[model samples]
Target: MDHREIIQILNEKKKICLLIDASKYATILTNDSFKFEECLRIISKLTSDLRIINKILNKKSPKDKITSLTNILLQLYGCMLALTNGDVSQENSNDKNNIESNSIKFVKGKYGKPLLESSMPIKFSMTTDKLFSSMFLTKGLEDTEVGIDVANVINYCGSNCIDLFRDIFTEQEFNYLSTSPNATTELQKARLFTKYWSFKESYSKYTGEGLNCAFQKVNFGELTIEDDTTIKTYDLHDDIGLVLNFYSKWIDSNRVLTVCYKCSNDHKDNYIVHKRIDLRDVLNYLNGADIFD
Candidate 1:
C-alpha cells in the first residue's frame, strides 16, 4: 500500500505490525540507488536536529542499519500522530504548525526498555532476523505492553540447538519435545526449539526484563503442534489480574515470528494488525509525502 493508505489504517486501528525486508534496504544502500547525501537531505527537512540526523547517518554496520530504519519509521509514525491529533511530546504539542518538530526521541524505562521521550502512550518493539525485520506499534494506555521476536530456523537447525539452549526451557517443555511426534526428526526438533525460544524471548521482552527474567519458570502452557501451520493459538498463563495474549506463526519455510501483548481476551482477533510493507513506501514517506491527505 501507499504511505498515506498505511497511515490511514494506523490512524483507525492505533496499532500495526510492519514486516520489513532487510534485503531491500541492503540493496538500496549497496547499489547507491539512493545517495547517502540525498537521504540526509530528506531527513534534515523532517528535523533540524543535526545531532540526531548525524547519528542516523553513521549507521553503517549491520545492526546499525536496522536501527537506522527504525529511526526513519519512528519519525514518520510521529508525523502520523501529529496529523491524527494523537499524543505527542509536550514540547512539540504545536508540531501541527511546525512539522520539523515531529521527529521522535526515546528514553530508557526502569528496566532499560526503550520508551518515547514524551509521556505519550506510543509503544513499539522491533525484532530482526538475517533476512527480515518486524516492528509492533501501538497507541494505548500506560499499562499496555507488546513484544516481538523472529528467528531463522536454518540458523539453529544445523546444530543441536535444543541441547545448547536446554537451560532456557522447563523440564516439562523438554519432555514434550522429546516425546512429541513432531520432534521425530532433527529439522522438526529445530523448528520446535526455535519456536519455543522465540516465544520465551517475546515474553521476556514483553515483561521488560529481557535476559534478566527466569524463562524456565515462565510456563508457556501447553503448546501442542499437531501439524505445520502458519498460525497457532494457545492459552497463555496470566499475571495477578492482567491477561496477556500471544500470537506466533511461520513467516515462511525458514523464519518464524512471535508476538506477545496485554489486551482484552477478544482483542486478540484484531488487537494488532499485520501488514507486510515495502521499504520504498517507507522511504517515500520519509522523503516528505503528505500522510494526512
Candidate 2:
C-alpha cells in the first residue's frame, strides 16, 4: 500500500503490518566490501538501541544475520515513519518541513519477543525467515497486547517435521495432525504443521515469550485443521487471557502467516484488526542504505 493508504489504514485499523522482500540485498551482502559492522550501525541509528545492535551481532552467520536484521530495520523504519508523517523520504530531504525520522529501537522482552525500547505506549513484533520477514505494530493500550509471526512452510516441512511437530505441539495437537482430513500424505501433514507452528509462534509473541520456550509448552488449545492449510479455530484457554483474536493466511503454499493478538474482553471482535501489507515506502527508503560500504 502507498504511504497515505497505510496512514489511513493504521488510523482506522489501529494496527500496521508490513511484509518485506529482502532478496534484493543478498548480492550486496555477498560483496567483499560489504561491512557488517557499519551496516548495523546505520540500522542502529534508526533503532537507537544497543540491545538491537548487540543482539543482531550475536548471530552465527554474518551475511544471514545482517540480511535478517535489515528486514526488521527497514520495515520498522518505514511503518514508524509513515505513522508519524506521510512521507519517509524527508528523513534526508532538503525540505525543512519534513520531520527527521524518529530514533527507534528494537529490543527483546523478557520472553524473547521483540519490543519497542521506548516509553511510548506502542507495541510491535517482528519475524524473519530466510529472505522474508514481517512486522506488526499496534497501539499498546493498557488492556491489550499485540504479537505477530510468519513461518516458512517449505523450510519447516523439509526437515524431520513430524518429529519436530511431536516435540513442539501438545499430545492432542499431534493426534490431530495424525488424523487431519488432509493428512493422508506426508506433505499435507507438513503444511498442517506450518499453521500450528505459525500460530504458536504468534501466540508466544503476543504473550511476549517467543513460544514460551519451544512452543510445546504454550498450548494452542483445541485447534482443528479445516482442510490442509486453514486452521478452523485458534482458541486459547480462558485462564490465559480475557479475549484472543487471530488473523492468518498463507502468503503462498510455501509460506504461512499468522497474527495472534489479545484485547480487553469488554472490546468487541473489531477492536484490533490486522491487514497484510507491503509498505512501498519502506523498501524505497532502505534501497539507498550503504550496506556495501
Candidate 3:
C-alpha cells in the first residue's frame, strides 16, 4: 500500500509522519473519555517520575482536555513502536509492567514538557479538542523540537470559544478573533477558533511546556483563518522573538491540522521538506514488517 511506500521513503530520508483519527480513540477506550484519562493517571502513578501527572494537575484543565492529551500521549507511544519497536500488539497489556513497555517513557524537561529519553532522535507534539486527537512525530531532526496540533473545525471551537480561550491570545490576536470579518458566520467563527488555537497549541508543545507557557505573550502575527496552507514567519513572546513557523491544512470538512517547526537559517529549507503518510501504513508496517526492533 501507499503507507508502506511512504514509510520506506521516510525511513530513507529521515522525515516524519503525523497520525490522526478523531474517533478511534474513544472507541479504543470504550467511549468513556474520563476512563481513558484515569487510565493515563494510573499509568502515571506507576512512573517514578511524577512530572507527567503533576503537569496535568497543574494545568487544572477541564476533564475533556485532559482526556484528549492523554489519548495523544498513548498514540505517540504507538508511533514510537512503529518507528523503533515493531509488532506492538504482540506485547499488549495494561498492567504496570506493560505500562512502561507498551508506552515509551518520557522524562520531564526543566519546564515540565515530556522529553523523549530514547536513543532515537524524535520529537513530537500532540493536540486534542473535546472531539478529536492528533499527534506529530519527526525522525532525523537533530537538536530541534517539533510541535503539532489538530482541531475539529466544528465542535467546541466556534465563536462561543473566543471568551473561553481569550487568555491564551495576545491583545492583538484577541481583537482579530473577536472582530475579524471571518468571525461572522458560525462556521467561520469555528474555523477562526481552530486556526489560532491550533497554532497556539503547536507553539506550546513545540516549546515542550504544553499549556504551561505564557501563551498570551506568544504572537502569531496577523493571519487569516482561511489560509489554505502553512504560514511561515511566526514569532515567540520575547522582545526579540525567536523564529517559528506553522504549516496548516484542512484535511477534510471537519478537521484542520497544523505542524510547528523551529528552523535556523541553515536548516530551514531542509526541515520544511516534510511528508504526510497514511496512518494505515504505520499500522501495516507494524503488523507486517519482518524485521523488528
Candidate 4:
C-alpha cells in the first residue's frame, strides 16, 4: 500500500502503532530507499498538515538530509495519530500555526535522539534492525520515551557470543543462565544472547544515549520484571529516570520480538501489559483496540 493509505489506516485507529519488519530490505542503504518512499507517501497523504516538512524537503535545507527529513515526517505522523481521535482532519489552528511558524522544529539531540522542539510537549523514540525500524509517540506523558529494537542474536556473536556476554552477567542472572538445563544447546544460547541484546538496546534507548553508553557496564540479566510486579531502582546513569518494561514473543524457534518502554511515572505498580506473537499480530492488536481497551 502507499504511504497515505497507511496513514489513513492508522488515523482510523486513533492510536499510535509503530510497525517494524526488516525482511523487506537487504541493507541500511536499501532500507532507507524503502523508508523514504514510505515517508513521501505519508507526507502526500498528510497534505493538510505538511507545511513545515514540505518546506524543508522542497527547499533541500542544509540542516537536515533527506533521510532525517523522512524520519521526522514519520515521527510527526505517528505523534498526530497518537494524540488525536480519527478526526485529525479537523485541524487544530494552534498546532497548524505551530507547524507554520517554526515553533516546533524537529531536531536531533545527543547520540541522535530525535526531539520535537523543546516548546512542543510531544515525545518519541525509535530503533531498527538490519532492515526494519520501529517508532512510538505519546502526548503529555511525563518523561515519556518509547524504544523498539530487533537484533539477530546469532549475528552479534559466534556460537560463543552468549558466553562472552554472560561473563558480564550479574550473579543472580549468571546463576540462572549458566545452570539452566536450556543453556546446554546452541539455540538456547542464541536466544539468551538476543534477549540480552534487546534488553541493552532498550536500556540504551531509555537513557537516550543510543550506542554512546557502555554496554559492557550495563548488564541486562540483573534486571527482571515478573507479571503484575515492577522494580523501580536499578543501577543506571543518574541523569536518567527510566522505567524499563518489556514484552517478548517467539516468532519461530529462532526469532523473537522484544519491545521496551520508558516512563517517568511508576507504571509497574498499576500497569497492564498486552502482548502478541508476531509483527502482523501486533499490528492487528494495536489497530483494533483503544489504548485503554
Candidate 5:
C-alpha cells in the first residue's frame, strides 16, 4: 500500500500519536544510487537536529568515509524517528537535540548489552528482520529498559530451522511442539520457530547485545494465557533483566508478521505500542493540515 493508505489505517486505530517511516531503510540499503551526498541531503531534510549529524560527520577524518558513515546515521535517525513524536522537515532546528542527547547515548553493559546513557528519561530498543522492523519506545517510568523485534514467519518455515534451535527451548516448549496434534507438522513447526526467533531477538535487543549473545543460553516456553504465544527471559551478566513477548499474524496465506517486545517492570503502563505502515497522515498533521481535510 501507498504511504497515504497506511496513515489512514493508523489514524483510525488511534493507538499512537507518532509514526516513523522505516520504509526507506530497505530501499536505501539495497540501492546503488544511494550515495553519501544523497544520504546527507536526506538527513538534512529528515531532521533539523544538526548537532548529532555534525558530531557524526566531524568525527570521520577522511572525507571519503562520509558514504559509509551515512549508514550509521540512518540507523540512529531511524530509531529516533520511530521512538519520538516528530516529523522530517527542513525548517526545524536541534532544539530537541538536548532532550535526546541526555537519554540516547549508547554504551556497553555486562555481557555487552548496549546500555543507554543513564540520564535520559526514557529508553528504546528495536530489531529488524528481512522486510520488517520493530521498535519499542519506553519512558523510564522507573528505570526500565525496553526492546522490540519483528520478522516474517514464512522465511523461517522453509529452512528446517526450528529443529536446529531446539536446544534453546525449555523442556515444556519441546514437548508441546512435538506432541501437539496440530494440523500440518510443517505449519506447526513454523509457528513454534517464529515464536522462538522473535522472542530471542527481542530479548537480545532489550539487553542491547543484539546477536552477540548466544540464543541457546536463553530459555523460552509458551505461556498459558495465550494459546499461540511464547515468552522468554534472559539472565545476562550484571543486574540487567530481559523479557520477551511474541505474537504472529498472517499477512497472507504464505506470509506472517512475527513481533516481539522486551522490557523490564519499570516500563509498565508508561508507554503506548503501535504498528503502522503509512505515514502521510501524520506528516500532513505535523505540517498543519486541517484534520477535517
Candidate 6:
C-alpha cells in the first residue's frame, strides 16, 4: 500500500510498518544530479524546527548531515500525518517551514532515544545499517516501548569474526556461537552471532540505555526458539516486572531484522505489524507533492 494508506492505518491502529529500504536514499544522496543544498532546504521545510535543522546541519560531513536530516524528516512527517488525520496541505503551503515549530516538539530519552512530545501515546524506534534503515512507530500502547534493529551477518562472516565477538558474548553465548551444535557451519555461526548482537542492541534501546549498557553483560544464554514464526520472548534479569517480546525474521539470507517491545508480566502475546515504506514515495512527499491526493 501507499504511504497515505499506511498513515491512515497508523492513525486508526496506532501501528505502521517496519521500514526496510535505504537504497533510494543512498541513490539520491550519491547521485551527481542531486543537489545537496536543495535536499537540505527540503528537509528544513519538512521539519520546520530550527533545533532539528541545526542538529542535522552541524554534522561533520555533508552525507552525514543529509542522511540525518532525511531520517528525521521521515519520522516527523509520519508523526504529523498521523496526528493531523492525514491533512497535509500545510506540508506544501507557504508556511510549511513553520509547521513543526507551530505544531510539534521532538524530545529524547535520557539515553538519546528519540521521542515525539505529543499528547497522544506514540512511541517510535529506528535503526540503520549500511544499506537499509528500519523504523517502528505505534500509538496508544500504555506503558509499552519499542526498539528495532537490522544487521547484515555477511559483514561479520570474516576470518576473525569469532575472535572479534569473543569479548562481546558471555561464556554461554560464546559457546552457542562457537561450539553449539545449533551452529555448526561458519555461516551458521555468523547468523547466530548477528541474532545475539541485534537482540542486545534492541533490548538496550528499549530500556533507553543506548550504548551505555554493556553488551557482554547482556547475556542471551537462556534464549530459546519458539515453535512458530521464529517469535521468541525473553525475560530480562534486570527487571522482573517487564518481559521482552521479540519478533525477528530474516529479511534475506544474510540480513536479519528484529523488533523488541515490552509485554505484560503474564506473558501475553503481542505481535507487531510490519510494512515496508517506499523510499521513493517518501522522497516524493518531501518534495511537496501530496501522494495521498
Q: Whose TM-score is greatest here?
A: 6
Number of clashing pairs per prediction, in order: 0, 2, 2, 0, 3, 2
Each prediction's whole-model lDDT (CA): 0.63, 0.59, 0.58, 0.47, 0.44, 0.65
lDDT (10s digit) by residue, model 2, range 1-293: 44555555554455666677656666655464345455565565555667666666677775567556766665556446443632434353222123226565556666666666556556667777776777776653545667677776666555366675577888777777667676666666667777788888887777776534556655665454332242233444544433566767666667777776664443334323334443234534444443333
Q: What would the per-residue lDDT of candidate 6 be over residues 1-293, giving only the tens digit for each residue?
A: 35556665665556654564655555456564345556556566654467777776787864565556556656765666555544424353223334545655777788877788877777888777654667777765667888877777867756478677687777888776666777666777677777776787787778778777666766667443221274467666673455667777666777777777766444344455667766556656557553223
Checking candidate 4 for backbone clashes, the offending pairs are none
* Number of the top-ranking candidate, with lDDT as the measure: 6
- The alpha-carbon deviation from the true structure for residue 184 of candidate 3, after best TM-score superposition, in angstroms, is 2.5
The residue-level lDDT of candidate 3 at 80 comes to: 45
lDDT of 4 by residue, 206-236 (tens): 5578767666565455333222143233434
Q: Which ten residues in a row have the lowest lDDT in candidate 3?
A: 284-293
**Model 5 regions more than 4 Å off:** 1-36, 40-105, 110-118, 157-160, 183-185, 209-219, 223-272, 277-293
lDDT score for residue 39 of model 2:
59
Question: Candidate 5 — number of clashing residue pairs?
Answer: 3
Better of 2 and 3 by lDDT: 2
Clashing pairs in 2: 47-104, 47-105
lDDT of 5 by residue, 1-293 (tens): 23232223223322222223334443443344344344444445444556546754675433223323333343344334334433223333222454344444556567654444544344455444433334444433334455555545566645446466677666766676665555245766676566556666666665566767466566554532123333333343333344444444443343333344443453323334344533233323222242223
Candidate 6, backbone clash total? 2
**Model 2 RMSD to the real structure?**
4.9
- 153 in model 5: Cα distance from truth in Å? 2.3
Q: What TM-score, computed on C-alpha atoms, does each candidate reach?
A: 0.76, 0.74, 0.64, 0.57, 0.55, 0.78
lDDT of 2 at 247: 67
